[model samples]
Target: MELQTLYNEYLNIKFKRGLPPVRTKPFEYGLYADDSAGLFLTDHPEETFTNWMYELIPRDPHYISAPDWQPVLADVFQQMDIYDELVLYYLLFTLNTTLSVNSHNAYSTMNDFMKNYSFLQLSHLSEITRLNEEQKHQVRDFFFFYYLYAHPVNEETLYACSFDGQNLVHTKTDIPLERYFTAFHDHYSTNIKEYTEQIAIAPHDIQACKHLTLQLLQCIEGKLAKLNMPEEKGLEAVLRLINDVDQMLQLHDNNKPALFEMMKNFLKEARSTPYRDHCFTTLLQNYASYILFFRFDEIHALVEYFEDTPEWCRTIINKIFMDTIFMERILRQKRIDITTYPNVTQFFEDEAKRIYL
Candidate 1:
């Protein structure tokens, strides 16, 4: 019933405001895709019609848990006056990220959505929801889930909810590294590999590596097939799609002898770490998996490789490690005897400031 009402209201606003009718899969993919349509309706349409248009963007299968939906929809209704576009976008985003997770259960799509949207916007939802004492504990638990798991930001938000008040101390939860890697492998595929032998055999010969890269690409395409990922989304295809060959090629160029040395030393060091459970064979397999998977953009080895550099360049190098899954995993593994830091954000920020300053 709500879906029909929402659809009817969308049509009414389109006719009244002379805006384009609803489009399916036509808008460019982004959070703001619906902003212009929303602004057109709110700017010129009748007040009642605009209010109707602001109804909850229904969840798929048209069901939302009472715990989740109540708080979210209340905030949407409360903020509909000023942040209409953002609220509408957030609903669509929630549907895509959290609600759509029934299919992609291994990895939380919420993390990606959190990366793109400002925490201030999220805090608004956190702020306006009026929860009872019993329900309040769940909010507190989920607060840590967002703070720890969401994309790290440089500075924290100012306005905080009761659950996420200023300077609230939250403990990070430790989940097994194998669990994370397994989920990631399942999502992408475990057949991904590092092409280590290929890299070692022809370090300086880019031509030789090209054939190896093509073989690697074919291997990836085959794995992606098992996962039902589109045929056109092979490693080379993603490179073309993003038009970022230079960065990846530069990564490839540096991998010749430099990457091999880094991998050997890193493996040597890992033998003593808590991750000692995974032998070199398993470690090499997973490392290779990530290298091939991260081929889309900003490709770096699971551990980065730096060519000959002076000691003073260490600060600059650490800054480069900021804001990557590789760095996050390194910190989590506790392998690399990095300077002790409280959290990934703090460590990354402190290192980043050294370079930026």
Candidate 2:
């Protein structure tokens, strides 16, 4: 059969079914030739045709399902050995269409559909191995976009509810990680000292300072975990402080002032302690990366610098920048001025230079 004849037949079938005619001429030709010849065609013909067709036509069966389309795609793949791209594109197209039609709860449905198809595993197939680096990257990018789109929420549900000044309340059980502060502030005050001293510190006279610090650290850990903050480094810092206090008390007869002094002295002395540095580094990194992405004008850039820094340093930086500088002079407001803080802009610029350089 002549390729044009087969092409006309395909179009006639679609036209008779009241479907829009396939507008991509090259794809129409490839489909007709590959199907009629039942042989692999090489050169750029197959790719050019497939790409044109895939781009022009909606892959959803509901909108335009040509029963013979799959065989045509298979023939093209069999001939050119680039089947995975076509398969993945089709899957994504279908998934996108499904979600679009069911917009209200599309995420759950799309996630369920993705779970059924192991595209990640299948992409590593021998056939796919033949694809060039660009093609591989295209596949990877598709999946990356798909994953991000399907799972829009990154944080936990703990912060979904706000406290109404009396009791804890949750707005949604399935709240994302980004909404953590709404929940945290609902139950507890932002005054870190209140939570740490009241809830964390043990009241018994016989309780070792090290034990109290450890318990306090546990409370911090629990709260942070609820915030969906990764726990490894933060927990390690707490443990290190606890162990250091334990050793100091054993040698210095349980001197509370001495222990507090030691903590202060350690921060002052090391100036380069790995844990302390890590805290600051994490703070800066998270602020620069995550906060900027969210475009939050309220949070100062210095917040990131102080994130991985010691809790004490965080307090000090906040007091100096937020309380004294931004609140008192920069914006001249009694409250901290979130917008137009020059120091924060300078700090963020400096951090960016340090990072890039």
Candidate 3:
């Protein structure tokens, strides 16, 4: 098996060099640590095996695919001088990004590996591989998959391959907006209102609007349920988690007001949940997100009375400072007093000085 060959190759290298046995994982959450034991792992030890240990990564069932194994084994190539471009690329080409983000970043991880070594450290990829015509086509197609076919991909994403003479050089191609947004809902464009405004300049596509509605629906249906379990992760984590959810919920649908009201009602139940001091900061910021999107019915859902706090000055006010035009109108129409965060007024004053001064 390929895993056996890779493992054997590692053992041969270690045996030839007479390095100490690897110490491996007592605890490994994601990836391996290079200097976890110490510089002595990379730096040679005394003839006795006293102060030397390295982690034997890629052991047992921990690594199944290139996304799992390539990152863990990359240090092997870098630390030891066994360069295998074909081996690395073969593993990469076998994987797809639809599974997890680790698959998505395989190219960027390869880029980081390439960025470390200069042309001096590497063999001329052409001389090393010596591929026939058909094999060369395989490499070219891999480029298309790595860039265009990956998740969170956009015009900004770079096409990449490792074995060509170009090796690290890659290209970025422009893609149409609606086609892009429809394929990937909230990956590239977070603020749906921004794209909604752009429809005037390039009118025809309402896919961005449609996608935003879908994203909100999916988040509420699937993701929000996981976070609301205050018993699982505690209330501080809940507040922080929900605030993270706040950033992604921007959308353009006629039903947005109703949907936001539903979300506000969900968060409203948290008042009785156990919480620490700054849980209210996320609550206020969540309300600010609603106000920014012009969803105002449950603007006072968290509390009937609003009071000023220094933390409010730092977070909610500072966040909506640029969008004060929308937020101030929401507060004013809701009969919420201006004293809740005076910095909203001060933000405009600072802007006034920057513009007219």
Highest TM-score scorer: 1
Q: Write down the TM-score of every candidate.
A: 0.25, 0.19, 0.23
Candidate 3 has a TM-score of 0.23
* Candidate 3 backbone overlaps, count: 0
How do the residues 1-357 of candidate 2 rate in per-residue lDDT, one tens digit apiece? 222232233323322323444443222322242222111112224332112123323244444444334522343233312222233334223322211112124445435223211122112211233345554343333333333334332232212233222122233332222222222222233343444533332222112212222222222222211111112333454333332322422322344345334434545555554334433333332222222222335244334434555565444434333321111222232243434554344443333324322
By lDDT: ranked, best first: 2, 3, 1
Q: Tell how far residue 124 is off in model 1, in angstroms.
A: 34
Better of 1 and 2 by TM-score: 1
Give the TM-score (vs. native) of candidate 1: 0.25
TM-score of 2: 0.19
For candidate 2, what is the lDDT?
0.31
Of the pair 1 and 3, which is ahead by lDDT? 3
Model 1 ranges with Cα > 4 A deviation: 1-25, 28-54, 57-92, 95-148, 151-307, 310-316, 325-329, 340-357
lDDT of each: 0.28, 0.31, 0.30
* Residue 74 shift from truth in candidate 2, angstroms: 11
Screening candidate 2 with a backbone cut-off below 3 angstroms (N, C-alpha, C), the clashing residue pairs are 155-176, 155-177, 156-177, 163-186, 279-308, 279-309, 280-308, 280-309, 283-304, 284-304
What lDDT is reached at residue 25 by model 3? 20
Cα shift from native, residue 34, model 2 (Å): 54
